[model samples]
Target: MQKNILFLVTGMTPQIITETLYALAVDSENSDKWVPTEIHVLTTAKGKIQIRSRLFNDGIFEQFLKDFHLLNMRFDDSTVHVISHQGKELEDLKTLDDNELAANETCRLIKLFTEDDNSKLHVSIAGGRKTMGFYAGYALSLYGRAQDSMSHVLVSEEFEFASNFYYPTPYEHYVGKYNSQERLNAQHAKVFLANIPFVRLRHALPDTHPLKMDGYQFSDVVEQINQSNQNLSLEIDFTHKYIRVNRGEQVNIPPRELAMLMWFADNKVKGKSGIKAPTGKAKGENSVAENQIIEELTADYLKHYDDLKGSETSIVVNKEFFDSTKSKLKKHLEKKLGVELAARILPKQNGRSMPFYLPIESEYITIKDNFKDRLVSIQ
Candidate 1:
């Protein structure tokens, strides 16, 4: 029951719209092919006029629908959006500034249509300037979801640029090739829709991402996604007490909290289990495994205290502090990184009796000891 929307980017040639629509809905025998309920065009003012004159005003658009026995095709002037520069509709994209404006406008429209939850967009980049088509496709790559698609239309050379050819008619229709005296039957001209593969980066962005915010530039969005794709690593600056999560901004943590997190991260990198004791252990006995973890954490905590709190100052390490600090560190990490990412650092408590541990694999973790050689280093 999803509404299908055809979003086309075109220049002087608006035939690509009808040709793409025909290939998607009518020409294909596949029952699953998408049939758009509405169509929208992104073009300059001159391009809009061309589309209006040849397709709408001249009755060519309606005639195509009628020929294919289609009903309720929604298209009008309101749907034909003219790219504007500085809030004025552009006559045509002629200069470098005009092309830049076209790119911005194309990106804006693609983002708007993709944000709608009710509509599944089919974006055609087969028409328009080379830069225009690139921006349209790239914009879709940025915001497009699983339901959205990007494509280009390919018409046989004989009729590709022919003035008389739009789409194949149900009945035999003759059309002349562009700049050639010979005429050919439109029915014999083959048309194909090529699906373009793009890396969908929308999944990497949170629902509250800045890209979803209005007035955000396209380049900024691409940069953010590229940063997110870099290998996941934790650069724990013990001196600074902050962790850089996934090449993003640094997350600051207090020295005490950093000690506890580094405890788990260090154990993970060293392939040591976070569980101090086996499941169902006695209440008071210090299991061999539990004691080892406490010893490791004590050494790590003492290093931070000695470096930042003076080597003469002494801090007690026991079950009370360990138990309380562990809980606080988990809660703080979760609050800073959100639920999904925190789970990577400190996995959820699985069972009532089972101890929690760092679930992030060792391969993805790096523990650097660059605090002036005061701390143990594990990479």
Candidate 2:
């Protein structure tokens, strides 16, 4: 028989799993209805401990199964995945880097699970931090199959977050309400599963094994999918001072920075070595290559000055302005599009004589044209 897998995102609340299972149980009178054959919880080290202590060890999960007489469900510590960074399991998401790692890890596991031909994954986003829930849902969107689904459990307001309210009891049972700490019967509580509609993107990915897909960052995967759909090409509007990345988002840059970016992009088109910015007094204002760069940058900056900032915007072409603009543009690309993608569209630097140049082929870069903005042939 094919497998039914439940992939749950949780923090200190393993109860969500029981509650979700309960919702599945009550939704059908059939004994084996939506009971998963296997369960996997994505959480942190501290969360795993809490789940083991409050749910598995205390017999809460087993008690729920026994109450419902569920014979097919299975879960254990081996099923609980504690997301780790650099080999050490993370206690909790504490910083921006940790969150990025979590997103990547979640995507990785979701990709792995869906890679199996016989597994239908059901993802639960009812517990953990808002970011965690978002990552879980987004990962499913990227790689989820036709049989896979996403949902959240909605508990009645009184029982919501109540310590004693894991699920509606098969028999009369009392649990304390969060606000007044008043006892309420678990059997009377209302629980429902709200199915979330998500766009399936598995078709956009190349047909490859999950293990072979391991090295890709989450953002790169998204970019590749988007590029495939859009047949990615760059559009720069000097008048607006913004460059459109693919067909999705537009990033606004200062005229000076835009000019610097354009110069490097043009060099790629011309098959010229990227000009290296000089340092200290000796490196200032001499070489034929550097002089040509200064001239071109000044012209590009001035060309956009009236349209971008109007006549009030002054154009400066000194070594200081040139250097600062280049640095700022790199930082902006890295910060906005992420390091993986920035490396593609931004100029690459090396210790060789040609210190920097656009790595993208000349064919993909285009200046302003009258093209209808519809799907034009990527030539």
Candidate 3:
């Protein structure tokens, strides 16, 4: 963390606390990068048992989390460090500047509580009860890099679904905690889904690896770290290096297919096999017409689409295009060039749809029958 500002926050909501704790837990156990140096949890006199997303008693939350994690374990490494706040520091600070008192007290705690070590990362995960996400993120902004930057994992809503289900009950948000199946389903889908997995911690646990996730992964994290000019000597050993360009780099490139192939080659992920399709008029040659319905539309973006923040139309189109393009592109890159570009898509606008209406294409993450034969050159 570059900011390295030391401070614990008070008066946080229970939801923030829960989410913040989960965020810290992800890399805390056997992580290769991005670990917090020290953390202190604090609650204020004003902030009391405010459990927003609670599925269990506050006393049982910790044990439940540990048990859930163990059950969901894949790679094993048990190490978690979090300290409970004992608000004695705020005893006599009415006379000092609020910000100054916070800073000085934070520093004093760091000095008194921790021994100076070689740890370069420092974070204040405890802050503004309701704004825990913002505070945690802000603290990291002061000193976080992709390799050692600030990150948060939000805790999802769960429930004590009352139904005929098995162990590790599915966690859900019940409209009615105990009654009204129809009303609860209408009010909260979480509760409805959990109804099937009732009486099981399996239902209580959330999905870990989605087909796709919002944050960066092992590969993207490394790339971001390498690219960031963080004023730190961060060295990433990418075995095979190659030149690349973004939309901003005013450079003429080959066809989208070749550019993607070259991208795979540069990234060292293996793209030599190339797209597999019968060439030279072997079979299904006539279907090429359908293969390029949006031929003019090549995949210009494969990384996540930051531009589709609000616009839903472009989001639909971009997603459809990216999925189709990447499905084909990944194959071409892997087989012919040997790498996989970040093959996700963005949203695009449709000229004909009504205002604020997004077009949903049935095809996503699926390639065409005749897509393998498209030939492209990088140079």
Candidate 4:
């Protein structure tokens, strides 16, 4: 059974888009396992033009047919069907009933993907604007599972994506200079899975089991450009030149990022046939993070939640009372305060004892809530 992946690509960024395609087209590991097919793009008239231009600009058209040498892997550009929302995209589903429309869209996307010979595995791997990614994944989840079609999502480069970044029509931050090779230049990342949408499809047929894929991240993506000897005119650099790892130079991924890299590199998001992100309570804070602050804090908190939860009271007095207090209300206050605060009064350097507050709190009277929400879990 040959796994034919269907990529749902979007956006006008030539370099990033095509570079992602190259990784899949010419994957080094599991070469025989996952084979990507044509792209099913959903965009406006302008975006449709962008796709046409990408074919010529990024050299993706040639790479797929010639460079990667999937001799039989033919791309019928005419089949690059456009599912216009009529100025109304995915989010606009509020206007239409999703239940009926998803059923309709599934048929439509399948029609776009169907070929003359047979029905190819439609793995969704498109990294366009946020909404593009969202809708692409959403539609795939509906169709891929509904009709037993394959669905996937590419894990875009790790960056701080703002929650409200997905804005209204005419998306912002689109760098439109129309350079084809640009897709080859975009940074590569992993693709995650569709838990909710997939659940819908999986629950439909008990016998039909869907495959899940993870990601693979190569540190030296530019080096991939070097290996292919392809040029995109984009300046690629790294502050941490060394990955602290001696080997795994394919993408220069350090040991820390191996798991994440494998998930995306494996085309798990091309419509869910490979490794993917962990989606459950098991995904501690660090599960969804980069070399960022939140993951770090989440780590700390998870480890020290208990230690930080119990409040402590710090108190100090002259050395004279140290002995009496050590035996006196010390344990009494601890029980009364209901915290870990202990008294540690001592003498001052000037031959006198100085009074100090407890180690943590004044007197634990009421139960305090947990600390504020931080990226790390304070132990």
Please tell me which predicted candidate would have the highest lDDT against the true structure.
1
Weakest lDDT window of 10 consecutive positions for candidate 3? 191-200
lDDT of each: 0.75, 0.74, 0.30, 0.34
User: Comparing candidate 1 with candidate 4, which one achieves the higher lDDT?
Assistant: 1
Q: What does the lDDT come to for candidate 3?
A: 0.30
Model 3 — TM-score against the truth?
Answer: 0.27
- TM-scores of the models, in the order given: 0.63, 0.60, 0.27, 0.34
Which scores better on lDDT, 1 or 3?
1
Q: Rate residue 25 of model 3 by lDDT.
A: 41
Model 3 RMSD in Å is 21.5
Model 4: residues >4 Å from true position, as ranges? Answer: 1-5, 14-17, 30-32, 85-107, 111-120, 145-197, 200-379
Highest-scoring model, TM-score:
1
Alpha-carbon runs more than 4 Å astray in model 1: 28-31, 225-379
- Candidate 3 stretches with Cα past 4 Å from truth are 1-10, 24-39, 48-57, 70-96, 110-115, 118-148, 152-379
Write the number of the candidate with greater lDDT, choosing between 1 and 2.
1
lDDT tens digits, residue span 1-379, model 1? 5678999989899888889988898885435677899899999888998899999888888999888888877889989999886689988778988877777777788888887799899899998888888989888887899999989999888787787689988778888878888888888877888888888867776555656667766665665555545555667766666787775678887666677677666666666665452222234667787666666656666765565456633444556776666667766765565434554666445675665567666776665665564333455
Ranking by TM-score: 1, 2, 4, 3
